[model samples]
Target: MALLDADARHPITLPDGTLYRDTVYLKNVIDHPRIKVGDFSYYTHSGKPEDTAAILAPYLGHSVRERLVIGKFVQIARGSYFITSSANHPMTGFTTYPFRIFKPETFGYKDLPVRDTVVEHDVWIGHNAAIMPGVRIGTGAIVAAASVVARDVPPYAVVGGNPASLIRMRYSDDIISELLSIAWWDWSLDKIEANLDALTLGDMEALRRA
Candidate 1:
């Protein structure tokens, strides 16, 4: 069966004939008020009827008031949701009721904090993960499936579990620093393809040489 309707607007199909839902579409994302998804990064469906292209922003937990800036080469698996800043209701007060939301003229939306959620390059967000508001996921970090990330993740770290804690670093500090310095993702397509072997398996020295 066809995954998406033939009349689907601005459908993005991969080389393998996989059609990504509307949330991952660059054109649609660029038009979004608070979400900025970079090149080569796309969202997948979780095989639920609620995971439709019609309401991609809500499905991904995006807020119209807060910013969600995702960098290049990010691998975001299916069912990954970003809990944006707008999700947080004012709790410092006696009641959690947001009267300001209803009375824009009297209180305005200034009471709501808008934290920018930043996901750096080459980060791998596994399936069913929920990234909390204001969290900055560093470059090359891996968020394991079903994890609930509530804090900032350092570069090259692997995190998992509820209130996700760092499990381990992907590489030694020196290697990670070197990789960051190289910034391979910024390279041209042809150049990157040429160094694919070194990037995937060989040492940093090999990548540098390439």
Candidate 2:
């Protein structure tokens, strides 16, 4: 209420030129079995997975373009921006009227396709990172702080910085192959516990020896 009242006092608005207090919008989220929206996460008004993915197609996978994904165990932390889409000016070279009044065909959106936000299992995206449209962050991956992830991140890799690049792989190629071969994360808890000796500390060759 204080910010709204403050905005009313003067013509000054926020840096994004966005006025008013705040609003949240969610839509068409489906098949989320174990997903949890944290208490601090905030969804923007009219944020659509489909619309956002349309702009992100060049940077993502077919799964991301599906527009219907389960945000299984998604953790959209505090103050982060999960933008589904954005509206640009009509580009008349000087057609600056108002942001909303521009025609749909002007700034590119005559054929706006919608996509889904799929944060696969065991993914950890850091605070204030922008998961741009249609990007698919793979399972067990970690996105670092204040990053602009504009591409599909490989499974189990740790990424950071704008147009986020590969700093390094989390495991050796041999270890990665072993983990994928084991694929125990998808197993039931009991099954994992039953095979605890195999899950950790057991070399792939050791399993072969067993």
lDDT of each: 0.73, 0.51
Candidate 2's displacement at residue 160, Å, is: 0.6
Error of 1 at 209 (Å): 0.6
Q: For model 2, how does the per-residue alpha-carbon lDDT over 1-210 read when each residue is reduced to its tens digit?
A: 222121121222579887423322122221232222321122322344334323222233332223423233334433455444333224454764544535654533433465555666556677778777667877657888788888888877999999888777777777767666666555555555566576467556654433
Query: Model 1, range 45-90, lDDT digits (tens) per residue?
Result: 6443344322334522333556778887787777777877665778
For model 1, the superposed segments whose C-alpha errors exceed 4 Å read 1-30, 46-65, 104-108
* Model 1 TM: 0.79
Q: Any residue pairs clashing in model 2, and if so which?
A: 50-114, 50-115, 52-84, 67-116
TM-score of 2: 0.50
Residue 139 of model 1 has an lDDT of 96
